[model samples]
Target: MSKSDQLINISVIMSVLIFVSAWIVGLATHKLPVLTTVLNLVVGLSIFIYWLQKQIRINQHIIEGREIVVLGCELIVIACAVYSIVFKQWNGWVKGFQYIFFGIHLSALVLFLIFMLTFKMNKLM
Candidate 1:
C-alpha cells in the first residue's frame, strides 16, 4: 500500500482503539458515559461519511439501492442517538423508536462486516 493509505489506516485503527478503551473505562467507572456516547456518535457519523465519499470517488458513481437504504438507516440511528443524548428523558414511544433504530444499526454493521470479509476472501482467492 502507498504511504498515505498506510498512514490513514493506522490513524483510523489507533483512534478506534482509543475510543474503545475510553468507552470501556467510562463504563467501568460509571463516569463520562455521556461524553463517550457523544464521541462514539461523532466517530460513527464521520466514518460513514468518509466511507461514502471514498466509495463515490473510487467508483465514480453514487451509491444506490441497498447501500443507500443502509446508509439512511445508519443516519437514523445516529439521529436517534443524538436525540437521546439531547433530551435525556425519553418517553416510552421515543425509547421504543430508539431501540428499533439501534437494532437496525447493529444489523447494518453486521451485514457490512460480512460483505467486507466476503469481498476480501474473494479477492484473495
Candidate 2:
C-alpha cells in the first residue's frame, strides 16, 4: 500500500525475474560460449543496475560508516564470485561443493543488501 511496500514488492518480483531469465539464457546458450558470455554479461549488468538503483534510493539516509561497511562486504562477495569463476577449476564433488559455497555466499549477500535497505527505510520512517 505504501510507497516503500510497493518498492519492496517490485524489487522482489524483479529479482525473481532476473534470476529466471538469467538461468534460462544460461541453459539455452550453454553450447555457444560467445552467446553465453554475452547473455551472462547482460544479466550481470542488469543486476548491477538494480543494485545501484536501490543503493541510491536508500543511501541518502544511511550513515557514512554503515554505508562503507555495506559496500565493502558487497565488494568482497563480488570479488569472491569473480575469483571462483576465473581461478578455480574443479570436477565432480569438488565442483558441486564449490557451487554450493558460492550459492550460500550469494544468498547471504542478497539478504544483507535487503536488510540494509530495510534498515535504512525504517530509520527514515
Candidate 3:
C-alpha cells in the first residue's frame, strides 16, 4: 500500500477509536452545554466528510456495498451528533454515540498535522 493508503487507513482507525471514546464520554457525562453540542456536531460532520472522500471504490469491488453501508453508518452518527448539539439532548443511545465524534475529529486533526509535515506543498496553478 502507498503512503496515501496508509494515511487513509490510519485515519479510519482513528475515527472509529475516537468514536468509541466519545460514546464512552457521553454516557459518563450528564450535562450537554451549547458548546459541547456544537462541537460534537462539527466533529461528526468532519469525520463523515473525510471518510466519504477516501472511500473511493464503490463500483470497483465486491466489498463496495459493505463500505457503502459503513458510510451510511458514519453519516447517521454525524446526524446524531448534530441532533444532540442542536437539541441539547438525545432521547436514546444517540447521546452516548455523540462524544466519540469529537475524538474522531481530534484524531484527524493529528493526522493532518503529521501529513503537513510529511508532504511538501507547491503552488498549484
Candidate that would win on TM-score: 1
Provide the global lDDT of candidate 1 against the true structure: 0.58
Give, for candidate 3, the lowest lDDT window spanning 10 residues: 30-39
- TM-score of each prediction: 0.54, 0.39, 0.44
Which candidate leads in lDDT? 3
Model 1, C-alpha of 113: deviation from truth (Å): 12
Candidate 1 residue pairs in clash (backbone atoms < 3 Å): none
Regions more than 4 Å wrong, model 3: 1-34, 43-71, 85-87, 90-92, 123-125
Residue clash pairs of candidate 3: 22-99, 22-100
- Residue 23's lDDT in candidate 3: 49
Candidate 3 lDDT, 53-81, residue by residue in tens: 65573555344687677567667766776
Ranked candidates (TM-score, high to low): 1, 3, 2
Candidate 2 lDDT over 1-125, as tens digits, reads 46775676576666555554655675586622222233333444555667678878884755578666755554544444444457543334434443444345446546755764565454233
Question: What 10-residue stretch in candidate 2 is worst by lDDT?
Answer: 31-40
Better of 1 and 2 by lDDT: 1
Residue 47 in candidate 1 has what lDDT?
60
Off by over 4 Å in 2: 31-80, 88-98, 101-125
